[model samples]
Target: MKFTTVFVALVSAVPAVFGLTINTPANVVECQPILFSWSGGQSPYYLTLVPGGQSMASPIKSFPTQTGTSYTWNVDLQANTIFNIALKDSTGSTAYSDIVTIMSGSDTSCP
Candidate 1:
């Protein structure tokens, strides 16, 4: 009886410990568009593409249909620039992905 109870308790705790995971492409071509993917979460979530600590001029994008675990965005990036992405749930819960580096142009500085 004790073993069965412990097993049930472990199974019940699994859902609470799981969270959404966001994954991006390993290598993205410079000055091109790329898609980001995620898994293990429900919908009513928002996706934002921001650089540094400032929000983009445009409004943050959202997914209306809570279907799959993946989302995609088309971003035009410049050379030697880094960007960050965030996934926010309806209840204000948020998760951040890793920094993505875009190297699309020459390294020379403008004179």
Candidate 2:
């Protein structure tokens, strides 16, 4: 039992030691460009945008490649739309960020 506990703890710590962070724009304006950023991972991280639980395999735009700790992409969002951002590292490990909701044009002052 003690050995199992130690193994679990070490495995869990691996991800934290590597350092990974994914973030999205605080204010996403409708019908405008929004940038998504992430950090602390390997190169060629996979980025995906899923809308309403549907796979957005083909994102409107993507970074294609990531270096260092972050990447940015511009996306056009519609009113009242919710999307999920997924990031997969080169080691086949995956992390998911928070959901992003887009407001309508009338609700936002974005051009």
Which candidate wins on lDDT? 2
Q: Which 10 residues in a row give candidate 2 its minimum summed lDDT?
A: 52-61
Q: Candidate 1, which segments miss by more than 4 Å at Cα? A: 1-17, 52-67, 105-111
Candidate 2 wrong stretches, greater than 4 Å: 1-12, 52-63, 106-111
Full-model lDDT, candidate 2: 0.66
lDDT of 1 by residue, 2-65 (tens): 9999999999987567677667566654545567777655677677756644444442334344
lDDT against the true structure, each candidate: 0.60, 0.66
Winner by TM-score: 2
lDDT for position 22 in model 2: 76
Task: Give lDDT tens digits, candidate 2, residues 1-111.
Answer: 999999999999987987666786677667566666777667668876666454445553344756555544434556677777777778766666677777665545433
